[model samples]
Target: MLGANASKNSTLTLVFLAALKGVVGFYSGSSVLIADAVHTSLDIFASFAVWVGLKLSLKDSAEKFPYGYYKADNLVSLFVSIIILFSGVELVREALLNITNPVGMKLQGIALGTAVFSVITMYGLSKYKARVGRLIDSQALIADAIHSYTDVFSSLIVVITIVGSMLGIKWLDSVGVLVISLMIFKLGTGIARDSVLTLMDAWLDKDSITRIRQNVGSIQGVKTVGEIRLRKSGLVVFGEIEIEIEGDTNLKRVDMLSEEIEKIVKNEVKNLEHLVVNAKPGKMSVMKIAVPVLMQEGLHSKVSGHFGRAPYFIFIELEDGKIKSWDISENPASDLEKKRGMKTTEFLKNRGVNVLIVGEIGEGPFHMLRDSFVKMLQMPEVVEDVEKVVEKVSELSTLTAPTE
Candidate 1:
């Protein structure tokens, strides 16, 4: 809203000023003022283009444009640059022709006053446009701001021509045209350069890329940030990243890791519209194992007589084959009349259980376990102690081999 209003206000004011310049220049017969008046027409056109682009750019993604219309801002900016460039070329040719054959005129006071008023008005418009442009991160507004600002410089050149004519220097009006033409040309070229680079999908910026890496680098299970890319349009930025995780990690865990990375990066980076995090399988040391037991026994405790009916279970966390930590919690569904096995399997899966060690598991939970990719080791008989059970699980499950 702010950007739209700013563009509208600035363009309208330029239109009014251009009208004043055209009428005044025609009466005063100053080629500089006349060319400047014509140039303001493009300013209005460019401003409208930018306004439409920004409006469309803010729209949501549609089936036809899956990536959204963010590129509209840059595209319009590029088109506006062409408008200014062509206007400048025409202005240069006119200025050269006027210089070759000077058109003398009865100097009118209205022209001088109009030139001064235009300079003041355009300067004000540029400042307003600049404030609104930065506020909303609108590329179109910024480009338009530049165009209006250069018009102020050209207006000042017209003032010089008027003063020179008053001082009886016949050629200064034509000389003013040459300087204004160059100014307009330079402005067009600079804007075009930036628009083309953005359209080409150039790197956003070094600082922004660093911030993205910093956000994703510290996430758990993200072994390495393999690739990070962001493409910016208008105020929005789209990103994609590749992260390395353990090759043995379950699919469910990988999914969780991918979501975590996306969340962290989006929260940290400003205006990141959407992020796609690809979890590349690699090797790492994070692993967990769970065993159902009748009691809360110590690390080397004995296994329970049954799987789902175990009153308590011990969850062991290991890093690089060595025990890191362990916890015991009561199995809430042990006394349930139905679905106890499935419920217990869910409980273990939520606790990051990669492998399950049990004496035996029912068919229903067994299928659920297989679907969740939980490595199950059904010992033929209950083990005498946890040490024996751990040894058997480490050897049987094709995950990490726990060290002695």
Candidate 2:
């Protein structure tokens, strides 16, 4: 609403300036001033078009246009570009004709004053529009602001042309018009390129996608971040992402995880209007198992009865029902008297341990590991050797079976 109102007010101001310049240009016979008036008149139409585009873009999604009317802003920008291009071509033709048949103009004081006023007014208006456009992230309004800035330059040229005519340099007026026409062409081409790219549904920049991926991967349940697809509609962005999760994850947890990912991405990327999270099962070709042991011995260490108080943890990597590798490390949290089990659970999780073989576990750690999607297997008896534990895990069920 603020953006639309700003554009509306600016259009009104342009209308006044255009009328003032037109009246004085004809009275003083200043061709450059008349060309500037034409440009300002087109600015009025462009500002109004921007205002309308902002209003239409704010419309909610409907049955007919499920993606909403956000593209209206881009369409308006493209239309404004075409108008500017047309005006530039016309001004160029007029400038060429004037250059061939140079006419001296009677430089009136009112014409010079009007050109000066336009220069100051357009400079201020361009700054105002640019501030508002950035605040609202409106492309149409920003393009309109650029249009206003061009007017400032063109009006300056008009001022120069009027002063040159006062100094008896009549040909400078035609050259000034030619310069403004070229500037209009440059502005139109830039706006047209940007608007057309947006209309073509160009993807978001790489930095934004990378930031989103890093944020999503930080979520606990996400195993891998997949393709991130994002597109912009005016100031808003829409996208979907694919994330790989545990195969045994429940539907309720999946929903929660999806919501978490969406929240993170929204916070990471500005103007993200909508995001869809697609969760899929990750490949389970290998299993990582953690076993609490009495000592930091290889496969010869005896499995400890108490999980949290154990001095060492044996990490085993099993691939395709065969033991691939194993490592043993001292449990740093075993010396802690309070919340040791919970800390141990966190330690194992950070190591990417998906399965825990235990003789006994405290209630806190049991629930925490379970919630973290770690498969807990009960050790029937105190196992003396770590190798026997691997055989036992393989015999009970397939390594890929979901935790009960």
* Count of backbone clashes, every candidate in sequence: 2, 0
Alpha carbon lDDT of each predicted model: 0.76, 0.82
Clashes of 1: 2
**Model 2, 12-128: lDDT tens per residue?**
999999999898889888777787788788888889999999899999989999999999988998988887788778777766776786666765678889998999999999999
In model 2, where is the ten-residue run with the lowest total lDDT? 395-404
Candidate 1 per-residue lDDT over residues 1-404, each given as its tens digit: 78878877876887898898888888888777788888888788888988888888878989999988999988998988888788778766766776676665555577788889989999999889988888877777888888878778777877877777787775665666677778888889988988898888776477866776777777654557887887777667778888776434566776777777777776666677788877765653655778877666676666786777888888877777777888888988899888888788888878877667766677777756655656666554535776567655557644232211
Q: Given candidate 1, what's the lDDT at residue 330?
A: 90
- TM-scores of the candidates are 0.68, 0.83
Maximum-lDDT candidate: 2
TM-score of 1: 0.68
Q: Model 1 segments beyond 4 Å from truth? A: 105-107, 170-183, 245-270, 280-282, 285-404
Model 1: which ten-residue window has the lowest total lDDT? 395-404
